[model samples]
Target: MSSETRNTANAPRPTASEPAPGSRPTATRRQVLAGSGAAAAIAFTGAFSELFAGTAAARGHGGYGPLVPDPDGLLDLPKGFRYRVLSREGDPLRSGEGEVPSNHDGMAAFAGRHGRVHLVRNHENRVTAKIGVPTVEGLTYDPAAKGGCTSLELDGRNKVLGERVAIAGTAVNCAGGPTPWRTWLTCEETEDRAGTNGYAKDHGFVFEVDGADPRRTGAVPLTAMGRFQHEAVAVDPGSGIVYETEDAFDRPFGLFYRFLPARPLGGTGSLRAGGALEAMRVPDLPDLSSVQETGARFDRVEWVPVPDPLAAGTPIRLQDFGPKGITHAQKLEGCYWGGSSVYFVSSFARSDEGSAADHYGQVWRYEPQKRRLTLVVIFGPDTDIQLPGESPDNICLAADGGLMVCEDGGGAQHVLGVTRRGEVYAMARGRQNIGTPEEPEWGEFAGVTFSPDGSTMYVNCYTPGTTFAVTGPWC
Candidate 1:
């Protein structure tokens, strides 16, 4: 069932809104988070409670002028931002639940009991890998599964206080979003068949991990949200609408989606409470992906109901319900909610990949109130994703409302930052010798997020997976 308008006249909204694009293609921290209506509906909450207590944009004050190369050669920051390794794939945990799993991807930070910050992180390992991460027999739904999430408790000083397996028995637990009710929505990135590839049940779905104890949630799939190659999600707190993306890389490109909760008007406001799923449509453009310019805004977008979220064997764009009615994009990844607008990335759409659009990466902004999607920035092939960046994956909004994008394209990886004015800067670079040249620090960056207080930033390296807590001058 599609969601109906709610009476959240008293509900809390995000403190701001994205700067309306026009002659001004640029954005400001205030324009990205502070405003009214759709702008007021974001932030950490459950049953409606503010998670962040500050009115300042998360950006470090006026922003650290420029980055200074790290003498250590691991990460580079603008003079003040510094990071510390928090946990690694084989690090021992407080519960003795084995070492932290590899392929760290999507993650979120939460305000925990007794003023600690809790992190629910995903491990993208699959069954094929000989991973030792175990499933909580009683709390897991798929015993053969090797991918899941872990939890870390950190003190105010950016020190890890404890760690443990948060949830297990799932596959490809990639990028996920934090819910208002204090939970993590870990998304499975594969559409693996249940009976094939050493599997017993379906693999592609979203699972909820409780901020308090992610282990207990188990393998329950939010079937209503669709079972495709999900990349990331951004939830609208005011409307209980979930914005989704797909990571399919071939011909029939991926389609963007929205899940309307069934409980609000009748269904509850959660994936557990099944809801109606829909796709994006751009009426004026025949092929939305064919665009060639940046800073272009397209208004008059609408949503069409998707026929079968789970049984649809093809990427939703190739389904009967979509081709003619919906718009398609390639490698639609990282998506974040800010200033009443949804920011999404098309890591790289290319003609050789059987895509009509050929670009290294794309950043788009969707305004809920105006029902429009604007191309905020487009990176060309010359951007050369080999090292220092390309194919921006998981994303987090900085304190100043700029973007902290995790690079997943090619060569060595790094975390790149984008100013609200559309300038991209190198925030962190990945490096390692690993006793060999072929495997010299090739893991991509993912799980970009910030502490609720904006005092710290967190990110992950996808291989020999590791998580780091960064603290420094961020305006």
Candidate 2:
């Protein structure tokens, strides 16, 4: 997602008559919530009412909402809740290892013994001056700068039980989801050729890490998963199928993809052995050039398997599914598999015609069973929740059944919460000056997760590189 959409203030608004993608005759939102345990509880009576009512009340002030303050700056939340910092950039990796890498991104949490939780996090830095060069002992990549992954063990109090670096010397480390077998898939979001940095010889694929042993070896790139600007990944436990999103910011839009692992419940070693890669295409809408030109909207989502997964070595082109005959959209970032649906976000679209929908980013939901795609929410070129700027990066399901978005844009970045009913709220704002005069405010929040009990929420800042654990009455 890019912040350029916020600069255009006079774009034409979208009319109700415009055909919205993923538009169903009936309400699909309710069905998604009804199917999941956490969603059912929050989308229904108890928490749902509170979230909506609070949001409606908070909107009366300026465009900004009231702050859900945390005194320790650990975690900010609504009333009757608190938070603490679980980890920070530059913190010691473990007792004697190196320091925690900067630019922390996506993360996943699993149950640990003695009432502790295990977390595997990503550092989305291709190259940075502050972190020196990125390097791993055996891996042939830069060794001084940024771009790495880490695993941590924390107790109920959000105290660090143990921590260590899992992998390093990667590029543009971005968001990835969890697998059913209890492992974390850290995605590398760059297509820089093999020798550019030595880390990406056959890189730009998803890597699996054992949450239990972060220091264990055998971390290999899964080349079978395809190589493009990889963003986030979601796996279907029942089918052992993996869905991926591309974050291409250039002219041609990125794509949504899926990989069916050759072997089910395969070891956490690599993605090379099994499965086939497939790009999603809309069967109904074959041509998208006219749609991109006229700014029309349509719902077209169908999955087509790639005949050869190895074809990833070449520049992979995605089929267009937009209305008016279809033109590619840019940067297909932020994705998650939940409530029997694949949810994804498109950062921005260039609009020579000045269409509102073009400048605004969109949240799309794909129902595999129905073989359909729908646009659930649209954020305009502004700072408000509904009118969010471009660059909607990573997303996670809140304890209250809403969506938590990390705004990776300029001008007062924030962590936004969007409800199931399509309402948006600012859960937290970027702190300008934490404690230093020269250090700028920490923005670009990525990687969000909640404890299994749903009592605590964890968030990470990609720039200054910080992680905080917030606890509240989210449910």
Give the whole-model CA lDDT for all candidates, comma-separated. Answer: 0.68, 0.60
TM-score of each: 0.83, 0.76
Task: Give the Å error, residue 54, model 2.
Answer: 24
Candidate achieving the largest TM-score: 1
Question: Residue 274 of model 1: what lDDT?
Answer: 82
TM-score, structure 1 vs. true: 0.83
Write model 1 residue lDDT over 1-475, tens digit each, in one string.
0111111101222122334332222232121211111111111101100111122333432234445555554555555566777887766677787767777889999998777999889888787754645777555757778888888888777667777777787888878787666778888888887786777888788887875665456657788899888889888766767889988756677888888777522222346778788888766454546875554566566777787788556655567764455678888898877767777888887787777867767777787777767776655434333444357688887765666788786665667665543344566666643336655546778898988887888988777677877777566
The per-candidate count of clashes, in order, stands at 28, 27
